[model samples]
Target: MSKEVSEEAEHAPPKDYTDPPPAPLLDVGELRLWSFYRALIAEFVATLLFLYVTIATVIGYKVQSQNDPCGGVGYLGIAWSFGGMIFILVYCTAGISGGHINPAVTFGLFLARKVSLLRALTYMVAQCLGAICGVGIVKGIMKHPYNSLGGGVNEVASGYSKGTALGAEIIGTFILVYTVFSATDPKRKARDSHVPVLAPLPIGFAVFMVHLATIPITGTGINPARSLGPAVIYNNRKAWDDQWIFWVGPFLGALAAAAYHQYILRAAAIKALGSFRSNTRN
Candidate 1:
């Protein structure tokens, strides 16, 4: 009976991946529709809330640490603020817009053919605008304290070279996007759907872990929008000077992650090669 059960399980088909065909470079068919606008609005609001909460946490942490270096929430708390917000926001907006609060994540998915050019472009614009508004609110409410803390803008620390900071952002973002892909992979999701929190949890944890590693070097700009929002608002020479690293690093990292996840780790290329070899042998 045990042998029969093992055989049956082995022959059971793997969970299906429900991916549609790659969308065209431009999908103008839905450009005039309400659904598209609703999705964009969702992205906007989610990103806005995300930036507001996370940046506020950073500013608050700085204020406390200034008063008493050891009394404040410290690095761990800051990491949690960013990660926890991501987990919550993703859970709330996943159904509406795939919960891509980060431009790097959206770009990665676009490269992997998960979103169309039109959707990707619009999502990016909305996210940036949302980030700007979110930080703008923080600045408005905490005017005196806001500029003092650089408004939580990401910048390279004194000792770290530009190369080191850029590399850190790249690897950090790669971990994030890779986790997003793995967590949301259809095969994994189909099997794990009963545990609804499973998908967003790892993604949040990735953000937390990356922050822990890179905070000392570059204040951890794994999200370009997160970096840009505050940098633009702060309008400082240093923040703007170091801004290119945040965008370039995250984008390159995201592209690497999309390619790795879709082609290698997920075995699409390997499976194709294996099938080809088998047919030739037969």
Candidate 2:
């Protein structure tokens, strides 16, 4: 009886899911496909629209709030602008390019082997260019206010130490990237699909909540493209001084989130080790 029970346990079907084989590190053949270029276009346009709407809202709010303490859209509104734009863009472009408007998200997926290095780098470049163009359009439209107001630049706000700002960015970006991993997890998709439209909702809300928490610290730059665009267009020395934090913090956060989800939550390392041992014995 004991032998039979042990054999039954050993032969039990697998209970957990693992992602399929990882994407190639580089797939040069992707360049030959029209769909690949189409995806790039989708990412570019999504990011452009995201920056345009969000930055314009920020500049507008600053202008309004100065005149009347309650006149402008408050920080809450700014958060909504960022979060809502993300939700909208993600929903629109999910099928086309996975709607990665932020480089940090792309980086996280790359670390998890969800995207190739080539695609990741190209997406980041597209996002940055789109961001720059978006902000440029806003500046052209509202030159005086764009120059006078903050230009939606992210910096260490008054009374916040550099360390505090950096920490906020890192943690904030971790929340975002972690949410991305969770939302896109294959296991979850196999279970219920998250309704497609609803899949991006939580990711957007994550952005909203992080912005609310970190707005005062560093204007909440979980997305480097968002921060870099305004800084470049505005050309503010203060913004430039703190640029390192935005890039470093988000990338570090992406790394941490990917490691956490893939190694711990998914037990990828354990699975690989088990496979290696079984193969050696075989």
Candidate 3:
């Protein structure tokens, strides 16, 4: 009788039979075909909106200076326009493609294991292309020689050296990326509680702050694409020469922030995984 009861128990279905299989880590079909295309389009459209509004502000300042001669929206205006546009676009597209208008953000997320390398590369290309289109449109409308406009390219002012310029960009981007990580973190206090009303606001303010601090020093290009647009159109040697700093500084800063968030802030999960591994080994 005991042996028969044991055999009956063994033959019974598992108690948690309703539990679903774990989702695939990567959906080859979606990642290769659908996600790639969707992410690219999202990047392109977001970047276009970013550059369009930003460059429009630049053109407005220039045109105003020429027309009004006395009163014009200054650097603050340009900064606000850029920052506001970023916030709006990010909120609009965050669900679609994570709203990474900057390559630095994409690379940072990739490093943090939040995104894949292929997606990052696709996003970067789309951003660059969108930037080119945005600035090209601006040039077409203004009929302004790219050279005279300096293509809205970023550069160190007369008093600043390359090192100083790079430092400014690094610091500026660090602030931007850090704020982005905080705002978008699903586990963050604001996000977890379902109170995300102020999420986009902080990001915009961070951009505004970075710009206010660095515009005078390096034109405040936390996004390389922002600089790329005007620089490519202007075809300025100075812009090209200084371009490396924009890419290097922002990327490093973003990577640092990502590392901090993933390793430091999320260390508990890492430790849990380690413990699980050790238990399995034992």
- Top candidate when judged by TM-score against the true structure: 2
lDDT of 2 by residue, 1-282 (tens): 434444544575875566678989998999999988998899888988999999999999988888699987799999999999999999999999999999999999999999899999999999999999999999999999999998989999999899988899999999999999988887877767546547789999999999999998999999999999999999999999999999999999999999999999977776666566556656
Per-prediction TM-score: 0.89, 0.93, 0.83
Best by lDDT: 2
| Model 1 lDDT per residue over 222-278, tens place | 998899899888899999999999999999999999999989887666555655655
Judged by lDDT against the true structure, how good is candidate 2?
A: 0.90
TM-score of 3: 0.83
Instruction: Give candidate 1's error at residue 67 in angstroms.
Output: 2.2
List clashing residue pairs in candidate 1: none
Q: Is candidate 1 or candidate 2 better by TM-score?
A: 2
Which residue pairs of candidate 2 clash? none
Query: Candidate 3 residues 61-161, lDDT tens each?
Result: 87677757665689888889988988898888888888889998887877766766667777899999999898888888775634355567788778999
Per-residue error at 132 for model 3, in Å? 0.5
How much lDDT does candidate 1 score? 0.89
